[model samples]
Target chain A: MLLALLRRFGQMIFVMFGISVLVFLIFFVTPGADPAARIAGRNASPETLEAVRKSFGFDQPVWVQYLTMMKKLFVTQDLTSFVNRGWKVVPAVLDTIPVTLSLVIGAAILWVVFGMLVGLIAAATRGSWIDKLLMALGLVGCAMPVYWLGEMMNLVSQSRYHDTWLFSWVPPLGYKNLSDDPRGWFLTLVIPWFTLAILYIGLYGRVLRANLIEAMQEDYIRTARAKGLSETRILLRHALRTSLISFVTLFGLDFGALVGGAALLTEVVFGLQGVGKLTYDALQNLDLPVIMTTVIYASFFVVLANALVDVVYILIDPRVRSA
Target chain B: MLEVRDLRISFRTEHGRVQAIDGVSFDVGESEILGVVGESGSGKTISLLAVMGLINDPNARIEGSIKLRGRELVGLEPREMRKLRGREIAMIFQDPMTAMTPVYTIGWQIAEQIMAHEKIGKAAALARAVDLLAEVNIPNPREAIHRFPHQLSGGMRQRAVIAMALSCNPALLIADEPTTALDVTVQAQILDLIRKLRRDHKSAVVFITHDMGVIAEMADRVMVMYSGRIVERGTKAEILLEPRHPYTRALLDSIPPLEGEKPKRLRSIPGSPPSLFDLPKGCSFAPRCPSRFERCAERPALEGGKHAAACFLKVAS
Candidate 1:
């Protein structure tokens, strides 16, 4: 197990390196955005541009710049943003990461627990009116875009009736650090978390319901029932564990994608300054350092999420251990 | 001892109500092996399932009294029935490969059964599991316990399943074609293991199989089922040698002896068993019975002594 983890860690480093190089090439080597011109603004003279280029080491070989960037990012840990006038980028990332992390983590907990309960209820009452109603609600949740939903929620709770009983005490729509005030942080992000979780709650509930129904049909489940295990035990212990395998895999992939700026719509609608919003802003400003930093950050999360999923596979399924 | 009396099971299919098992009755005496012989869809599995009160499909309905040591099992609540299933009466399935959960190790799976009914610690359960594995003749039980179901061979998996069925020392063990998916040699070993375990545990067994050779070898009593009902039943020798019902006779003749030179044309039962949905009005086997007559328009009830057959022609003969 230790050897496998070490191998995976080594693979993670190589992947992160490849991702960093890709980000560098896309930002620097690409034709559309000129880092030299952007850093020296339109008012600067040709002499100032030459000096800026030389100081930033843009005059060096491309390979040398790449090596220097890697050394600064990994070894020296002094990654200065050219667009931000040589201000360090890592601190800015650290400031925003907790907000995003809390949002994702809270939303994950909400969706998983709520989805499982809804799924179990739906499956238990399959073909009943309750099952149909829950499934229809799930369909609506799946179809509605998160941004539209978030905006609608804000319009009602924040804009339309802030003092009304229904809207009273609603979160003010900004993220606060959990370390600063846990209660304030939770209250502030609660709506965003729910809004972000709605779609996944529906998707995961449906996936879980379908998988649970299928898992119950397995011969082993029948054997469990035959063994005189209580209905609750049979469903929870045998059926639920098998169904969770697919759910876990989906969660891993979806979490990684979300961390990679897929939740940009939610972040934008909620006015939260997460990686998604940061990446969007960097894209708009053509900020290479910020964009590259976000890319590397998101790639690390995606790869790390995949590694976590691989570890979970061993716990969820014995067959996967040898594989 | 277990007794299934006047058991009836039906399913509402698209076509109509399909009577899966119609008025089937049998008994498993103490330490006796009652072999239920039937082709697929002949209600052999359903009969045992009905007795266990495991039929939960909405379309299916069951009626009858399944008395285990004089306790009625049919109308008991699921919780009460479940308490009896693995503890008092255990069942092994046909496909050993799929019978065990894939996510857990063999030891954990068996230990789960032990812990389900007994108040035992994990360490003690593990020890009991290893002992059960060794009892089932799995080589290197200590090493094998840590291995998952897929790691074991087909025969080994079946042994593991048998070990689990016997873990609680159930009074009745229902093995539904336990060796159907195994090779001939492996099949023999499993049969031997089951017989040995039955002797060791002193538990009555209900063995379901279509193989006459297996039934002949392992069964003390035989119940020959056709068209969702027992056509003939008797001691193993009576059913094999003097099969009163034509269906039973046909089944016995169908088995080709291993020592003899192969017959150019082996005996095959004429016509298929009637579909449950479109069963004929009187005797279900009349269409396929060579000696069928007008009197067969009335269904024959089980008759004779300990060895009985539901046949109008046999009764007259």
Candidate 2:
């Protein structure tokens, strides 16, 4: 186990290095790209541009510039954003990490719980009307776009029926710090959570339902039933146990992507200043330092998520250990 | 003891209704082994699945009587049937490699069965599981209990499955091709284990397989099934030594003798069994029977006797 963890850690470092090189080349080494001029801002004096270029080492060789940028980002930790003068890229990302983690983690929990519940119910009642109805509802949720869904949710709770009893307790757009006020944080993020989770709940529910149905047909499931275990016991303890492997794999990818700024649409619609929103603003302003850091940060989550998934995969399936 | 009378099973598919098992009846006496021999598609596995109340297909229809100790089990609800499973009746399946859940330890699975009906403490159940492993002659029972299904060899897995089936001392044990997937040597060993388990537990056993050699070696009585119907049944010696029904004779002829003049070619019954769908109007085996005559065009009744054969020729005599 320790060896596997160490190997995964090495892989994570390699992947981060590769992504950083790619981002650096695109911003600094690409033809016609001028970080010096961009940092100096539009219609700057030649003296100001030269000063910025020299100070930031943009006038140095490509490798030297890359090394200097790495030192600023990692060692000195003062890689300021070109668009926002006072904003340090690393600290900017760190500050928004909690907001993104809250949104993604809450939505992940909601989706997993509801998805498994819906999937289990659908599988149990497979050919009945209950199965059909649940699956159809899941399909509808999966088909709806995240941005559209978030807007619709806001329209209903924040404007259309803000004074009504149904949405009276709804909070305005924006995120709250959980450490400052736990209840307020929860209430504030609840709608965004549902909006973000709705699509996944459907997609995961359908996938889980299919997986469970297939697992139920396995020879071991018949053995479970022959053992006199109740259908519930057989379904949960035997069928679902094996079925969760695929679910976990899918979750790792989805969770990592969301934390890496795939939740930008939801954050923009809900007015939450998450890493996704931060990345969106950086992209709009062509902020190279901020974009480079966010890209590397996102790759870290993706790589880490995959490593965690592998560990979980071995935990649930013994056959993999021997293999 | 177990008694099945006029038991029929039909399945509805997109094409039409298929009569999978047609009016089959048999009894398993206490401490006796009844070997059910049949070729594939003869409902060998389906019949036992029905008996175990494990057939949950929505399109399947089951009728007639299944009585365990004179209590009707044919119409029993799934909830009530669950109470009898593992304790009153236990089943071992065909593929030992896939028989047990792969995630759990073999010992945990056995303990699950023991606790399913016994209300025993976890420690006692686990101790009993270890004892069962030892009873099945597994080496290092203590270590084997913690191993997963894939870690064990094929023969060991079969033994573990058998150990689990006998954990609760069930009165009726149904083994469906329990050794079919094993090597010839492993097959012999599994058959011997079943025989020993029968003697030890005093449980009536229904051994289902297509290997006639296994039937002869393991069964006290044998029943031959063709196209989901019983074609012949008698004492093992009576059937093996002097078979009556042409199908049974054909089945016996197909067995290559260990010591004898080697035939130019091994005997095999010509043609496959009739499909459950689009079955012939008369005898289902008439198309494939070498001795088929004019009377064979009509259905033959399964007559009652110490040795019964479902053939018009036998009835005429």
Candidate 3:
């Protein structure tokens, strides 16, 4: 088991290295992406430009620059954004991590709970009107983009229905730190969480439904039935247990990607200053250091998520342990 | 211990209602082993599934009566059936590899079945599960209890399945092709284990298989199903030695001989069972029977002969 874990750790390192190198290559490949002039300000003297270039190591060879950038971004942790002018990109990215984590984690909990319920209900009531309705709702949820949903929610709560009973509790759109005000943070994130979760709820529901239905046909289920298990017991303990394998895999990837700034659309629409939003603003200004920091952070999360999925697989399925 | 009368199970498919089991009936006495033999789609497995009340397909339509210890079972509410299941009636299935939940250890699966029917703590249930595993001849019951289904070999898993079926000491144990997925040597060992279990526990067993040899070895009584109906049934000795129905005779002839000089090529029955979707208007076996005659155009009732055989020739003789 320890050897397997060590192998997984080694694989993660290899993947992170590959992704980091690719991110660096992609950044340099773009024409006119150099940051020296941008760092020195709008119209800078040659001496100042050269000085800024030396400090940032823009004049160094590509490998040396890459190593120096990695050292600043990770080891020393003082990488600065050219667009923000002296703002430490690492700290800024780190600060937004909690906001994204708050939004994604809350949304994950909601989606997982509701999604399993929807899938379980649909599978149990299969071929009935209720099943059809749930499936249709799930499809609609998947089809409706998160940005549109977030904006629509914002319009209803903030402008159109703020005076109504339902919307009266709606706070102004923006994130609050939990440390600053726990209740305010909860209130600020409630809508964004739902908006972000809606798409995945539909997605996980459909996937889980299909998996549950397939699992219901397995020979073990027949044994379960013949063993005289109650319908609920059979569904929950036997069928649903096996069906969760695929659900966990899907959740791991989606959860990781969302926390890694893939929630940019929802973040932008809801006015949350998350890592996604940070990456989005940095992109428009072509902030090199911030992009680099966010890219590596995002890759770290994705690789880490896949590793976590393996661990979850070992828990939910014994067959994976030997492999 | 068990009686099934006029059992008919059909399914509503896109084409039409397919008669998967058509008017099959049989009885099993306490501690008796009744072997059901047939080709694939012969309704052997379906009849047993119906007996266990495990046929949950929405498209299925089941009719007739199943009586366990003189109590009506057909149409019993699922909740009531659950109480009877595992406790009064348990089932072992083909392909033990797939019959046990993959995620759980063999001991856990066995203990879960025990707990499902009895009011026992987890530790007691687990202890009983270990004893059950040891009874089935699984080596190192202490350590083996922690092994998952996939970790065990085919024979070991099948033994574990049998242990689970026996956990509640059910009055009736239904085994559907339990040895079909096993190799020849393991098949013999499992057969021996099952025989020992019935002898020791005195639980009536309905063992379903397509192998004549397995029936010869394990059955006191043998029932041969063709298509969706039983064509022949008698003492194991009677059916194997003097099969009267043409279908039964063909099945017997198809078996590779052990004593006589080997044939240049092994004999095989021609054609397959008729589809339930569009059955011929006569004996289901007639289309495949080499001795099919005029009387076979209409279904012959199971009658005449020392035992029962559903063939016009047997009736006339």
Candidate 4:
């Protein structure tokens, strides 16, 4: 067990390192992605571009330049944005880390809870009208894009229904720190959280319901019935418990990408300065340092989520341990 | 200890209503082993499922009387059925590899069974589970309980299933094709264990299988089912020695000849069993029977006392 965990940790580090290097190589080696050329004015003289390159150490050998960038990113943490003058890339990304985390974590919790609820209800009432209705709703939720849903939500809650009792409690669109204003943080993010979770709730519900309904027909379920367990006990203890193995895996996979800036559209729709938004801004300006850091950070989250999924799988399924 | 009469289970599918079980009836006394033998789709397992209150298909319509210890089982509320299950009647399903919840350790599964019917503490129930495992001849019972079902061999998992079934010392123990999925050697070991369990617990057993040879060794009375009806039933001696039904004869003839005799081409009954949706009005086996007669157009009811066969030739004779 210890060895497996250690191996997983090593794999995470390897992945992050590979991603960092790949992004670095792409930025420096790609034609016209040169850092100094990107920072210099577009119509600058060749001498002016050469001067910029020398000042930024881009004239050094590629490996030396890569080391310098890594040191600036990790050790001194003073890497500046190329397009946005005087903007320190690392601190800006770091400052927005909690915002992304707050958004993704809240949405994840909502999705998982409501997703399982939808799945359980659908499975229990399978083949009935209620089941069909939930399934159709889930499909609709899945098909609706986050940006579109977010805009629809904001339109109804912030403008059309602002004075109505239903959405009157809606807070202004923006980000709030949980430590500074717990209630405001919750109020501000609730709509965005729902908007972000809608897709997953639908997807996860359909997936989990399918798994749980199939699990009901398993021989173990028959054994459970013969053993005289209550329907609730059988569903919760045997069916749901086993079904969650796959559900947990799916959640882990989605959670990683969401935290890794898959929530960019949701962040943008709500005007939250999250990693996704930061990455989007960096991409617009071709900010090499911010792009590199965000790439490493996103890969780290994805790999970390995968590792956590493996751990959860081990806990949920004894059979997985030996494998 | 158990009585079932005119039990019928039909399902309303999109195609038509399929009568899976038609007027099946049987009884099991204390310390008795009633072997129910039939091939796949014979309704033997379906009948047992109905009796166990495990039939959950919403399209199914069940009708008949099933009394256990004189308590009416038909129409018993699910809650009441839940209470009676595992305590009064426990079942050992076919395919032990799939019969157990794969994620849990064998110990927790067994303990869950015991704890379900009683208010005992978990530790106490788990301890009893280990003892039950030992009783079923599982090696290293203590450690075996901690292992997942997949960690154990097929035979060992079946043994664990049997151990779970016997956890409550149920009055009626139903083993449904429990040995069909095991190796020949493992089959014999499971049979021996089931026999020992019956003697030790004095529980009435309903052993369901398609293998007549297994029926010979495990049953006191044998019931032969074909297409949702009992084609023949009698004492083990009567069914094996003086089998009356042509289907039963065909089944017996199909068993491979014993050693020391010259090897010969094996005989098997031709034509698969009919579908539940489109069963003929005549005897289900009439079309396939060698001695089918003109009167076979009309279905023949099972006739005789102590020994019975649903065939005109046998009744006329």
DockQ, all candidates in order: 0.72, 0.81, 0.84, 0.84
TM-score of chain A of 1: 0.93
The CAPRI classification for model 2 reads as high
Give the Å shift of residue B206 in candidate 4: 0.8
Interface RMSD of 3: 0.8
**lDDT tens readout by residue for model 4, A244-287:** 98899898889999899989999999999999999998888778
lDDT for each residue of candidate 4 in B41-152, tens digit (9 for 90 to 100): 9999999989898888889999999999999998998889998899999999989989999988999999999999999999999999999999999999999999999999
Interface RMSD of 4: 0.8
Of the two candidates 2 and 4, the one with more favorable lDDT, higher being better, is 4
Output the worst ten-in-a-row residue range by lDDT, candidate 4 chain A: A32-41
Off by over 4 Å in 1: A17-72, A75-84, A164-171, B118-131, B139-147, B289-301, B315-317
True-vs-predicted CA distance for residue B192, candidate 1, Å: 2.2
Indicate the residue-level lDDT of A93 in model 3: 91
Q: Name the docking class for model 3.
A: high
The number of the candidate with the highest TM-score is 2
Residues A198-315, candidate 1: write the lDDT tens digits. Answer: 9999999999999999998999998988777777777888888878988988998889878777888988998889989988887887777677788888888888898898888889
Model 4 clashing-pair count? 0
In angstroms and one decimal each, the interface RMSD of every candidate reads 0.9, 0.7, 0.8, 0.8
Between prediction 2 and prediction 3, which has the larger TM-score? 2
Clashes of each: 0, 0, 0, 0
TM-score attained by model 2: 0.97
Off by over 4 Å in 3: A1-8, A29-57
